[model samples]
Target: MRTKLSSTIFLAILACLLWASAFVGIKIGLPYTTPLQFAGIRFFISGLIILPFCSQRRDYFRLILKNWKVVFVITLLQTFVHYSLFYTGISMVPGALGAIVVGSGPVFVAIVAHFSMPDDKMSLKKAGVILLGLTGVVLVSLERGSLSGEGKLILVGIALLILTNINSGFTNIIVAKDKDKVPPLVLSSASMIVGGLMLFLFSIPIEGLHFSAKPFEYYAALAWLSFLSAAAFSIWFTLLKRPGVKVSDLNMWKFIIPVFGAIFAWILLPDEHPDVLSIAGMIITGSSLFLLNYLNRKKIVR
Candidate 1:
């Protein structure tokens, strides 16, 4: 049990790293490829890679048919709308700023889950922590000068990203409720397949069915995003099923992602350097998330 726990933690950390790197990768890749094209191809590749690994092909299909409504709703909310908003938002705003904005997702998730999931109730302590985290995020946003000029546009983008997070939280609640009835792997696989196809269809008019870039880095970024989507999500869903791994537990490690994302964005876009205020904000954000997770875990243990 200890070994399994350790392995799960390791995989979760790996997922965090991959997810963090995705922000940077997307920023780097965007210069070479259109957002729609990037999103479409990434999902398509992810679906293809995960298709072979799916166990019980007949059962997978059967589950899809059995729960078509649930599957479609989740795919639309989690994949279609979420990725579209996120990718479009990133395209409009600076990657690090975008990361910081979206990093407040846990707070949003907590708020939404509190009302939606009885098992995931929010406490006053968690609320305080979430508020502190949001303050830190706001500080980072202000320090990045995302509150001025075309910053208004970025704010709109951030709002859209927050909506995506809310939808994701709701999707989690739905998944948690139905996890026993439907295999997570099957659900995840079908969502990707359906979601990928939807994005591909949307990309037709926006990005067209064309491939232009041949740069190694561009291809590498695409591969990374695709692999993470295809493989990492399955691992994530499995970890979610494990006892004691609450959604709140996942929020603790979320802060580390923005730090790496900010660094990577800074490296790739030298113009977007982090000021001292932004650095302090990152520290505060991390601290608050840590406290939130600690408190939640303590409550769980009791």
Candidate 2:
């Protein structure tokens, strides 16, 4: 039991670290690559990496054919729409702010799951926790100056990010509900391939098949994002398969990404550190996330 618990904790920590590093990686790579090009390459590479690990090609194809509708919806929400908006938002907003906004994903997921899944019923306790988590997100967003209209375009970028989070929640609930019916490795790989192809198609019009970055930074970012996607999603899906792990529990760790993003900005950008008010805001957000997690855990155990 102790060993199993330790392993779960390790995987959770690994998930957090992988997610946190993505913000830093994106910040490092964005200067050299356009958002659409960057997302396309990352998804393409991720699909390639995941292709080999799929258990059976024939079975995978059958599954995709049989479940094309659901698969398409998941791909659109999880990969196509989520990445397009998220990358665009990341490109426009500060990395820390983007992380904070993305961190609100669990709140959206809980709400969606409550309405969509009979097994995932909503409780007053869980609802309260979700509210707390949202409070944290709002605080973090405000601290990051995401609430202010830095510019009209940046404000639009923030709205895009909120939409991205909603899509993330949709994807998570979809996977959690269906992971037992479908093979996760196959689903993950196929989604990436289809989604990457779709993004490639879309990019032709918006980004025009451009590849104009120095070999070092551009390829480096692609590599980082691909690896991050593969590692993070694998562990995330694995955890979702575990019984009794509420979506609200996941929100507790969300704040870590923003904290890491802040650290990354300080080290890499040097000029984007939070002001005193921002620091205070981060504290409030962090506390709220903690409270949400605590309340959810207590409810789960009782």
Q: In terms of TM-score, which candidate is strongest?
A: 1
Q: Tell me each candidate's TM-score.
A: 0.84, 0.81
Best by lDDT: 1
- Count of clashes, each model: 0, 0
* lDDT of each residue in 1-302, candidate 2, tens digit only: 34544465567657776777776677677777567766777777787787787777668888888888767887788889988898778667765566566777776777777777677767786666666555655555555554434667777777999888777777777777675666777677778878888887888888776655376866776688898787777677677666665554554566556655565566666556666655665576567656654564455467
- Give me the overall lDDT of model 2: 0.69
- The 0-to-1 C-alpha lDDT of every candidate, in the order given, reads 0.72, 0.69
The C-alpha RMSD in Å for every predicted model, in order, reads: 3.1, 3.4
Per-residue lDDT, model 2, residue 17, is 69
